[model samples]
Target: MFRYLILIMILSITLAGCTEQVKVDMQGAGETIPTGSTGIAFDGKDLLVAKEGLIAFIDNIDTATAGSIYGYEGHFYFDRYPITITSKENKPYITGLAWQNTAGNTGFIWASDEANRRILKISPQGDVITRIPLTKIYPEDITFDGEYLWVVDSKRKKIFKLSTEDGSIVSEYLSPVPVPTALAWDGKNLIVGGLKNLNNPAPSPDNVQIIKLDPVSGNVMENVETSRYLTSPAGMVWINGKLWISDRNSGKIVIISDKGEPSTDIRSYKLPAVAPVLKKVEAKEDKNKTAQDVDEAKRAAEEARKAAEEAKKAAEAAKKAFELQQKK
Candidate 1:
């Protein structure tokens, strides 16, 4: 009998361990951008998002409005009438963008159009100033240093510095590896992320290695170890000395401090499963028991059950709300 009781106790303990649940508390929930969105840049207070054929300027980043631009489409300036720029007969999908002041009057925004294999120079008001055709390379991310606009070619695994005034290649530096996704300029150095081996059949790990590159020579200066929680980072921008990355697969945004520590600030919405409603479990089983004892037991059990029910209901309500919001 003693042996049997010990065996039963062990089994019960194992079952209890198996039933334990893991909880993940998120900081900023219900904040997300559209799928397939790649590059993001902040313009002081607003945010610029590049996705597919559209480049939109969001006036408010805290409360993002979908498919809305404060200025005109294909235009850059936030004030005055909208100026539409012609693509110079090339309908390239714009991937990355960077702003620079060339002269006192003229401000230039350099945008890399990967589809047409060219980098375009546009005026502040969205006029096609010039387009520099790139051969044997596909440009992905772009950033502006003090003098030049640095562009990343993921396929060629090279970083090219182009003149902000005219679309001319100033210098080109070959990267150590392939699959460069995002670029961040830290005043002194450039940080690159998004490493992937497409040939491998198995799924790649979630961890993305952040490599710091010397802007002048385009050589690897140092590498920062990132969190293993990120699956694929598509866009990254440095705000107030912190690096913010958007995970494409998870539909979430992660904030990484200058020290290379990462934390998830956004969460993706998931639908709740349908379940049958059940009656509340009662605690008062013995009618002949003392009134006070029965009352206390009933109240405790009712409170516990009510708390659990409220949690489950809240989860379901959140799921439903998310689904409804997505439909809009």
Candidate 2:
């Protein structure tokens, strides 16, 4: 009976090890993008980026608190070159990308082609599943909201919700900003970049913040300040209740928090006040100084009086000499 129980425990331990694959950072040692990578999507722990001329995936990365795209080492890349668009072969300008995690590693990715005016359904193995054409839509960034896809066009200032099956329009609404560069769905609200209010007479880019919108009513929920380091955000994703934004200018990904600065209890802070004992000491010092000043004043008055008497005697002697000279 003891041998049978030992054999069962050994088998269970062996099976558990076989079920999980060990994650190694070296698996993605060569999967890198040179500066122009924009469109970003995640597949479990892996990351997909639209490299300038191709789409690259970096495996075994945790971007939840990761700093930047270049901060990771090692990459295992599979490239799809000269992506076909509008029945023509060219280097596609892929702007926004969304990934739907499906069975095993057989999920699909949706990419917004800005220059070609279309959206593409692609397989993880770089296969083109389908393409949906767009009319007068200059798509900037895209995000997945359950069964629908949300595409933001900064030029048209419109957000479109589309069907994932055939990319048909489901609904549309006005964007909260004049130009929204990127969009992400944080479970409940749609987070968009570029928060300058052009409606105001003087608009500034320093007003750039994270703008949250209601997914259904298209209403502005709130606009929260982001770190000054974030500039020219291209794509964003929400994970672990924090927003991760990809910045184009810095070529890095940053975690953003909507909760502003923490409050402090200023009422508990008291200014240092002078004590009554110190005030009395200062008053005594002043009184002694005043006495010294009076002594100095009396000495100055005596000196002045002596000098005036000497001058009067000299003037009387001069007047008598002038009278003697007139008699001579």
Candidate 3:
């Protein structure tokens, strides 16, 4: 009986060695602000941006918590933003950021380390909870649809649905777009951004498109031409009833309204919040006021003209009444 038990224990040990368990690094690493941001995610209240080698969280898009992690500074469109960063030993290139509720209310930020070929689960407070290695595929953009996490494997030409518990692949299929760059969930459908045509040297701005697809079957439901002027879109998110996309080359974020026809109501960021140091003119009244003032002046002029017309009609009526009395 003892000999039989020893043989069974040896067999179990051999099986365990065959499969590698994911290493959960609780210590985390040193923090460094990324040189550039590539992806963005919103966690109801805060906005998380994925930089090349770091993940930054902006508490309310306007303000951030101050500390070591949040003290790291970075420039967005020439303006300085107080950004919180995620730490890693040898900062691997990160491309995507997605909010997941794997740990209940605390929440977790899912990041795709493209260079290292792995996915990292980080706490909202900048702690690296765990990492799942993707040995073969290169992940670009990632999106979470309530239950499962989906990743765009750019190099493999595939989109994969991964288990949140362990970054194990649940299912994967060929992407409808040849070179998919951005992914977003719009309540019911998965919206993907890709190049319309392969321009040999580089993709043309006019050929950029955002395609809506069935999350399960990956069928093209709608193809919306984004803009004839936008550079290849990098990150996309549905926020405040509009689709916000970032251009890869220009590093500018553009807002597109959800119109039935291909969106023409597109707006691009003109400049950063704070002007450059040398160009720090006065407090500078709101640029929006100029447009508003023109509209207000036009409205006042219109009202004055209407009043004058009404007054002229009243005088004419009085004059006609006087004439009728004289005739009587």
Candidate 4:
């Protein structure tokens, strides 16, 4: 009987050992950041990352994060470190960023501030050139189509075309779906994707599908579904003819070929932990409520398990004592 029990224990341990570990392919070469990395852009050589309200640049496609943009040669990368240009005003919750070079001399960075419902144009030197007021409540994503800037009104289920020069809204188009989270332009068509506020009770589809649309008319051209590759697509950038998309919830960036085929996963570098600041009252309240509920449930489960074990041991001991008395 003891031998049989020991065999069962061994098998149980073996099965537990065989359980799959979180098999993250760490094959693609890049760095990993904390939780919320929403935007990624590549300028020929280096890569740019934007999270929260800060931007950072990296040199080697493999190197994830760089400290300062100065002294970096080849392709200039942008970092969140306040340069003379971005340091003067209050830092906005920057979600989307696009850069355009006019006349090959002056470069402008178009950034979207979701919290402020506005977009700002920053010069290569980091100076805020202009701020465009947006009627959309939450402008989560932004992209450029050579001549115009496209902004995603995530909460309003709409897309707005704004003049790159003054941030003036040229036109707005209602999205056929809900929650448009990301935007990309393939020279001819604009691609958008996010959760479909579908009626089904099951969670919205995990796939990241692109809605190809005419850049001029804002009319849907075709739907390209990306289920096998992307989980939840957020920010995207077209680099060297390939599309690089950031998966906001999955902590991954998927690279798609110009033909819209899944190519490789862009490597993300691990970023240094930033000090946690409880600035917003609502954020703090939500944190407290979540912590309290989790703690209470954990404590209750532990207590119940402990009581069950104690009762089982006591019962075993009592049975042994009674059996010995009977023998006596």
Predicted structure with the largest TM-score when compared to the true one? 2
lDDT for predicted candidate 1 compared with the true structure: 0.62
Q: Assess every candidate by TM-score.
A: 0.56, 0.59, 0.58, 0.58
Alpha-carbon runs more than 4 Å astray in model 1: 1-31, 63-91, 101-107, 200-207, 217-219, 251-253, 261-328
lDDT of 3 at 57: 54
> Global lDDT of each model?
0.62, 0.66, 0.65, 0.64
Ranking by lDDT: 2, 3, 4, 1
| Tens-digit lDDT track of model 4 for 1-328 | 9999999999989977652222223223123332355766554454556676666554433322223234221222223343322323555677777767678655677778776777878775667788887774577778887789988876777787778776766676776446788887777877777766534354334534576666555456665655444556677777766676777755656566545443132321112334646585667889999999999999999999999999999999999999999999
lDDT of 3 by residue, 155-199 (tens): 776777787787777666666667788887777777778665655
- Regions more than 4 Å wrong, model 2: 1-34, 62-90, 195-205, 258-328
- Pairs of colliding residues, candidate 3: none
* Total backbone collisions, model 2: 6
Clashes of 4: 12
Better of 1 and 3 by TM-score: 3
Among the numbered candidates, top lDDT falls to: 2
Model 2 residue 226 lDDT score: 77
Tell me how far the alpha carbon of residue 140 in candidate 4 is from the true structure, in angstroms, after superposition: 1.1
